[model samples]
Target: MIIFGTSSSTIHPAKLDGGCCPFCKTKNQMWIQGYRKYFHVFWIPFFPLWKKIYSVCSHCKGVFEKKEFKDQELTTSFEYFENNKIKIPWYHFTGIILVLLLIMLISILPFLTK
Candidate 1:
């Protein structure tokens, strides 16, 4: 069976200063991260979907969704990270190449057999 799933990569850490982490109560110790959804077959990520944002408490290691951060500073930080974030090419539509190659092989198979 083909495995379908999503994956995550560290787009950015807590490089810039920010507010405190609610869970750990540590000032300026929150990290902004993201999870990029992808489709996988045979455990290989093929196609990517939308990405989601999260806040990680550096001290307590508590994870919070984007909506969970109600603080103004934290909200602004999140928006800043998102705006400056860069998109990697390999993280997108990885399965399209495989699909196209398969199609080409299938179309040529009958001709080869004849």
Candidate 2:
């Protein structure tokens, strides 16, 4: 049986003072974070897929998504973090590495047989 699945983890975390939380109306309490999803085989991440941007209000425990960011300051901070901080980790390519090793072995087997 082949074990394959998807998983997500927090890749970035930062405090945003750009806008007040819509729910709590509190400034400097919103946290910007990034979550990355990856495909995995047997619990080992194989490759990365989509990234999700989220903000949470610590004062009221409210959550927001990328589309919900309305304030210009909030949006700017989010874009900067996404563009500069978020990156696919190296471990996510385990599947590709395994496949390449398998291919190499197969190629070498033919030479060894002769």
Please report, in order, the local distance difference test score of every candidate based on alpha carbons: 0.72, 0.82
Best by lDDT: 2
Local error of candidate 2 at 75, Å?
0.8
Model 1 ranges with Cα > 4 A deviation? 1-16, 86-89, 100-114
Q: How accurate is candidate 2 locally (lDDT)?
A: 0.82
Candidate 2's residue-wise lDDT over 20-75, tens digit each?
78666787788888688999989988899998888888899889986786677777
RMSD of 2: 2.6
Look at candidate 2 and give me any clashing residue pairs: none
Report the C-alpha lDDT of model 1 over 5-108, residue by residue, as the tens digit: 76655565554368777666688888877667677776566877777777888789898876777677877877787777646548456677878889999999
Task: Name model 2 segments beyond 4 Å from true.
Answer: 102-114
Worst-scoring 10-residue span by lDDT in model 2: 16-25
